[model samples]
Target: MRYNYPHANLEFAVEALNISDESTLSSEDFATMMPRIQSLALRTKQWVTVIGGSRQVIQQLVNAGVSRSRIRWVAGRDADQREWATEQALLAGTSSVVLSFLDALSSPRVAQRLKMASKVSQTHSFVFRSLPSQSPLH
Candidate 1:
């Protein structure tokens, strides 16, 4: 199962997804998400915040057709804390979408904050959580 949030004028989707590795998204899974990000970025010609992906993943996204110039990688030590990154993105005021490989919707407060932040910033937040193989978080 995938978590979802509502954002008028912005699209948010989550589907039953699985990756071969429990820790990272497979190439195919990652590939499946690029076009949507690319589409959003290309429309505004603004940066797209990509949170938590490593250098290899970022490079793969570039090679797979996501614009290199439009990508703003945010794989810092605190990247897992989606709220902070989303706050930073909102503060920047130049990005149209913030794609985070995190469980932003896992916490009620974070989810609510993200909703308000996206609305105020006029941007979209797409949080991606690796489907847990064992127990659920919520």
Candidate 2:
């Protein structure tokens, strides 16, 4: 794995992979996506968001000796919590917003909130989503 430890913190769009804890996805997906992340990271001054709730990945980054000062991992169950996370990320100058469990909620309210976050963040923010197949969200 090409681990870039001690990444500088900034804001960028988040892209989600399989997203949910429901799937045992591979690291290859992340490898494939990282080039894009790296490209965006190079073009702009922002942090790339790895959209998932996997403590393993987070821990891996930490274990790889990535600076905690540069990365913020958002984990919670409420949409409002996510909203709060968005705000925190912006304040922290995060560059990406990755949304997992996209099919967990179909309410336009959530989508609107995320959209608003992106809008509010301007080009500094990007959103990545992973939707389930034929799923009904809460």
Please give the CA lDDT of all the candidate structures: 0.59, 0.44
Q: In model 1, what is the error at residue 59, expressed in angstroms?
A: 2.4
Worst lDDT run of 10 residues, candidate 1, spans 12-21
Model 1: CA > 4 A from native = 1-30, 79-82, 103-106, 130-138
TM-score (C-alpha, index-matched) for candidate 2: 0.45
Candidate closest to the true structure, highest lDDT: 1
What's the lDDT of the predicted structure labeled candidate 2?
Answer: 0.44
Q: Name the top TM-score candidate.
A: 1
| TM-scores for every predicted model | 0.62, 0.45
